[model samples]
Target: MRIGILLHALFYALVLWKGSQASPYWMGLLLGSGAGFYWYGYNLLSLRETDTKLRGEFGSWTGMLSSLATMAAPLLSGFLIASVREIGYPLVFSLSLAFFAWAFLISQRLVTNEESELPAPIFCRRHPNWNRVLLGNFFQGIREGVFVFFASIMVVMATGSEWALGKFTAVNALFSTVSFFAVGKLLRWYWYNESMLIGSFVSTGAIALFLFGQNYRTIMLYGIITAIFTPFFLVPFAARVFHVIDEAHERYEREYVVEREIVLNGGRVLSIIAFISTYRFLPREWIATYLLLVGSMQILAVLILRNVGFRLKKSF
Candidate 1:
């Protein structure tokens, strides 16, 4: 985790120093590799730190905190960019570097007493449930790959202002934070299947509203609906994944994490390629169609989870 944050800080430092001359491909590589390392370590720690009984609550708090950060960072960056045009981007990058540095320092205090074990080879055959969990993660990633970027871009296009996009994102984050809080209080182990089912249907169904119109109002409404329900899907799904990990041998936990990342990224890459491929053959006005198609992929994830049964032999 420290190494990952250090790499992130390095990326921002380079951006601040080089400005436009900084190679985007290199920057992307740095950021991508940093995220890969960060998430791998983060997931491992999450599994190690929390047990099955508290996993859902842990996930909710994680989501809530992340949403809070999401809500604040964009608004602050937008305000700076609008007010301090001369050095706005540099300031943002510098602040990001500072934050990453702080995170790295904080990570140093995280001590693990467990002995290190070598990870099993990537994608090694595992329990049937473990493979199903991987498939579910892949389908979830497919939806995320397109929606993460496309929805925000559509909002910017509709409103024709970065400030509006930031406000839109903040609003969504506010809703998400509230939803996460509610999930934390209300979620139970037995409710996993029901929560995911409801979340998947409502969030995906919200995309159909975009088909009616791709304007700011529709986009905002879609964002709000999805935001409120997404935690319902995400918190349980994450907890369930951890539960599956718990069922496996301790030595293979790191290996499972690597396999999950690989399949998730593969799904994301496949989704993006599909989007680009369709763009060449489809009309430009079919933006909503593309979103709907990708967003619906979450339904597949929910189905896979349901088919495998979200319950374990020893219930939390």
Candidate 2:
């Protein structure tokens, strides 16, 4: 995971610098999409190996920590872009790379000799439940892509400032961060699937409101609504995956918790491509409406998963 972040920091920097040289938005997105796809594949390979050696909760802890770093990347990037004007993009990326490298070094030092003492895992036959895991995670990718594609245009149209872009994005990030901890506690006390269902309903309603918004105030209001519900939608998905890992571990001593990090990022890469391919011809209002349309798809996913008896089953 540390290596992945290091690669991401370096990758984005190069893409941005080269994109600036060409200065075309679609071109930049194309480069980013390709890199994202490759990252998806790489994460799958790495996580597959880790799955065999680690217990479910232990695997989840590592994944959660890696995600913590991923969450902080944008804030760090924003500071870099804001502070370093002379060698801005590249320098920002370079700093990100340095941070990731330091993290990797720290992770290495923390590894215990016992980590390598575990025997190799005996493979289990593929499980049908894996498909559901993939589906749930894939929609999350679609959700993120759809949100970014449309909301960015709306912010630009409403405020007419790139700076507003940074501010609202920061706002969204902050909201998501707060929701992460809040939802963690919520899950501890409440039903996992129920919270997610409620979140899905709120998200759908909020996106619908986004279609009606025409100014910063409405957009921020919509953002707040998203803040309330978005974590519910996401956190349960991780919890569900952990449930699967736990179940697998119960039957197979050396359990392999298949990581969907690859598929999730791959879906995002595809969504970005789809966004770039179609966004130019679409009006801003239509983009907002399209986002609402995309969000609605989650309702179908929820129904399908429930019908198939994929109930929430978190151990803790």
Which candidate gets the maximum TM-score versus the true structure? 1
User: How many clashes in each candidate?
Assistant: 0, 0
> Can you write out model 1's per-residue Cα lDDT over 111-184, one digit (the tens) per residue?
95565665567777668988899999999999988888877888877877767888988999999999999999
Residues 35-148 of candidate 2: C-alpha lDDT, one tens digit per residue: 554454443333444432232333334444544554466555656666775666677656755765675576565433233445454333366665576676677667676675
Say what the RMSD of model 2 is. Answer: 6.1
lDDT of each: 0.88, 0.59
Q: Which residue pairs overlap in candidate 1's backbone?
A: none
Per-residue lDDT of 232 in model 1: 93
Error of 1 at 186 (Å): 0.4
| Cα-based lDDT at residue 196, candidate 1 | 94
* Model 1 residue 173 lDDT score: 98
| N/CA/C clash count, model 1 | 0
* CA deviation > 4 Å runs, candidate 2: 12-19, 22-91, 110-126, 156-162, 248-266, 273-285, 307-316
